[model samples]
Target: MLLGRDNMKFSNKIVVAVIVGLMSFSGVVVAEDINTEAIGNAIGNITSEIETAKEIQSEPLDKVRINWETIPGAVSYRLVIQNGESTSKDAEVKHFNRIPNNGYELDTANMFKAKDYYWRVCPLDYDGNVMGPYSAPKPLIGEEVNPKAPLATTEFEKMAYSPLYPVFSWIPVDGSGGYEIRVSRENKFSPGRYEVVREMTTKNNVYYEEGGYTWPGHYMWQVRSQNKVGEPNTEWSEPKYFDVEQHVRVAALGDSITHGGGVCNVPPGYAMYSWEYYSQVPIKNLGCSGDSVQVMAQRFDRDVMPFSPGMLIIMGGVNNFRAGEDGWDTIAAMEQILAECQYHNVIPVFVTATPINPGLMSKVPTIEPAAWNWKEQQQLLNQWIKNQPYHVDVTPALTDANGNLKAELTTDGLHPDHLGKKIIGETISNYLLTTFPSYNLTEK
Candidate 1:
């Protein structure tokens, strides 16, 4: 016996009170006028409906996707989802001990049911210990929005110095065979509005534009996922804007250290981790991660020619040394880079290679161990760098007496964290101000 639709309009408590009042009134009149059994059934149906409404209101979402803010100095994160009556750390339905990024998509098809679910995340250190307390449990309430195209993850700086070779990266879509990227002076993205458009198919998640934009102006770029047959799978991502300027006062060119990023999970695309971000002076970052001295030399023509900066800060050879390349070979490559700078009338400022800690490197799975003779090779290269015409030695500030990178300054041993990058930037900033007093005159 269910309550009629019209009866549901009344509050359950009010309806029950009204029924009790009617029964008392009926005792004073003809009791045969009202059916006692029908009244009892109506009361039972109303009670059941009230309980069902509470359940529906309490657990509204059928599926959920979780996202959280990135914690500084966190190497990874711990995510836990529990489904139970209370928000306790019990009845764990799913637990991820380590998540590299700030987001996770739960398997709704198999994992979620008509139950109340709560989720929380905690920042973790390299050793997997919790760096901070778990976030307050958040109600997991909505279906994950799955886009057809890959999601763009690169965070572009608002302004960049001339010779812009921006790195574009994205989270790969589950079924995407490849991706397409477009850059334009206009955001409309019409046929002729594109300034630089290239469709590339690569399994890797990043792309470095070799033919970079030279002119200083505003630019817009977007990316989309594609299938193996070259058909578009997703709509183009929302356009991201960045500005490029000509006639920059200074610029840093090197490998991952100069390219920026640390703490394992963050990528060089983030400006906060770059030394340039902390410097008092304005310096364009032309650094690329995973680049050796040889690769830097090879790309010099394509990367540096467009901007043709007034001054170029050269820092490299760590990649070569860590891979066991000979010291002289690395030195020779640096010389080649310097010779090119001199020919173009660009002031070449050499930044000495910082040392590495094998112990720290071993802890990060993505970072390979330093070669047996890496220290010897690094010393040789640094010594040569010091002899260059204009140089900044950040080694002394970053390394210990044993010539190893200070553990406090780095998370992965190879790349310096924010604090270490601050030291490097300040050191270089002080040097530039003293050596070239007019260096930052053109800074805007």
Candidate 2:
């Protein structure tokens, strides 16, 4: 049966034409048949989304390079680098290239200031037709690595009792090769006053365990970082002050929420009030943001016990809950911390985890949907806390009827604001006065 050209499938027509041509050339010198399998495989080799370096590679501007894997069937590649922070793509397009290789070495001509950039690659065929899909956008210096000293967090103006070696810690700097920590008795960093010089290869956030800080003396410490590329060390960080007080009346230890947050609409978002505002006794704020119960337990000796506080208020657990831990896990960690306090004769006071709201939870981009389960664990932990002999319940005064944070008391659902801080401070103050009758708490 004769088939009309329009009626025949395209692939069938190609096969019929090829067979007819072979038959006609049977008696003549004809080349071998075209390999359809090879053609199909070649087309299949054009893979989309070429693998590339981390959106932000930890390198300085001059050392940065745009790198990607070579794609099959790709004769060339077109690259685009744009300012990630720009409002329009054209305004920030710093470099555009149709290069022959899988990577591009950047020079000052296409370089930008210390800022974030976006980059992508599109595979091209021999004639410049795009072969496969453009890669997903990647950041060039998505986040700039910290080029200098990490800020020292613990032991800042803190006084540790003698015989207790305090741990020192700082915020981790991205892309740092290591850190050099220096401690000196005199603030001037003179020749003889320096006590310790240690280089840390571990992540900077963890406390340095080598102790030797003595009591009834003033000490200062600073930190600087080695560049990731083996470059010279960054400038020394500003000094932080610490004193070795023989006796500590009180200390507040918890996660970042305890460090004082929800200070938005106010400046310096983390802390709104200091230790002096919360307690009438000589106390220190030993809170670090994002610390889980396990983290607190690990640092108990260096962060909490060194103060030799007569009363220690423990408020934490939300981070653990958010990380998928339940009430029992949190309680176990709490028991360990409480036991440590007991061993040292330091009184322990338990503070309930603050509340969270569904409305406010979504505002934080990094917080996942699983965070919704945080409240249930928090409630269970808070209830268990209240059952303890000595505890302060912030949940009752801090929550709304629906188990969410009271709107007026918090700037974010997690951390309290002025109103909530007042409630907690007053509650702790009352507990301290009633628990320890002889201690004088006049402001110094």
Candidate 3:
């Protein structure tokens, strides 16, 4: 039977009748005889499916869909839509700043009066300033169409250390009911040329593989959208390439700063915001966003032991200090991390915590202001860091005369932007090149 919107109410009534009949068959229905748990579960499943169908049917259709390729190093984008052939500022009908993704869907019912329109996009830095030339203006066609394939957003190629447990992610399609991801060992994708490693469908735009790759080798992945009826709505996206290496020379472990990304909206997956992206030498990113010193110490074996690198760069405690954690407690957690590294035969390298800017922090509502004594706590931590066997001081370059993070280098004030990240990367890179020249070989 076709279970569609028209028949859903009728179907629900029938289901209710059946349930009543089953219960009424016996004067007093026993839980054991009716299998109440199974019936309840079945009803729940049906309700969930019905709700999903309703959601898909209620989604609004876009009047026009605009898509662009992701630009490297861009924290966000500025999208301009004009009324005529000219994409100039004077002819602009609409302009959007800090668009976090490569695509946008516009509802032109009331917005577009002209038959022809043009749109262009320019990548932006954390401060909303244009970072590159605008994309060639493309005609914006106003028409209803099927959902388009999602754009893969992960920068797998730039990752210094491919996680044993990898997360595949992509931009969400405007009208998609769900997504399907396919991974293969070969790039060709054809039946004979490619060996399919894994294929799965999900309602989410991101998927985490708990059981990661068993063997290290080259891998390629792509994603596509599905319609409400579970049919393919769009073709597969351009495949992203990445390698699963068996080992690495260096790895970095810490919080969001070590993980990369900034400017509030952008994530570490963008690569350009990653310090590892700017590093001359390859350093695996073991950084996790929102991680505290205690959490880092807790997850060290699970997250860090897989790659088994010769050196592990540790930079954390910002989250701790900002949240008002005690300096000695934070240091104790760091000491645990250092001890674990020693046990694993990995050289522990310390990176001084970068200062925070409260003025900018207040600007982004999502970011909490640092503790009143965060600077004092940071000084305590940095002093301990300086006393470590191997350390890299990034504070000097990022701090101002008053010891606050330089205003120009960050957007959110907590996470540094590309320029600041570049400084940190290059500083660590130079330190690695000078101190451990043997591990400085170019990553394949």
Query: TM-score, each model?
Result: 0.74, 0.49, 0.71
State each model's CA lDDT, in order.
Answer: 0.76, 0.62, 0.79
What is the full ranking by TM-score, best candidate first?
1, 3, 2
Which window of 10 residues has the lowest lDDT sum in candidate 1? Answer: 142-151
lDDT of 3 at 191: 34
Residue pairs clashing in model 2 are 157-241, 256-289, 260-270
Which candidate achieves the best TM-score against the true structure? Answer: 1
**Model 2 bad stretches (over 4 Å):** 1-183, 187-217, 221-240, 244-246, 261-276, 441-444
Which ten residues in a row are the worst by lDDT in model 2? 263-272
Better candidate by lDDT, 1 or 2: 1
TM-score of candidate 2 against the unseen true structure: 0.49
Cα lDDT, model 1, residue 175: 58
At residue 43, give the lDDT of candidate 3: 92
Residue pairs in steric clash, candidate 3?
Answer: none
Residues 1-444 of candidate 1: C-alpha lDDT, one tens digit per residue: 677766664555465557667776778545445555566688788889999999866743433446676687788899888785355656677788877766665655455452466788899987899989988776665424344445566667533442256777665455567788887774344533557644555655667665556665667778887788878877887777777765566777888888877888677665666788767777888887788998899878877776767888898888999999999999999999999998999999999998999989998788788899999999999999999889999999899877899998888898898788889988998888889886553364
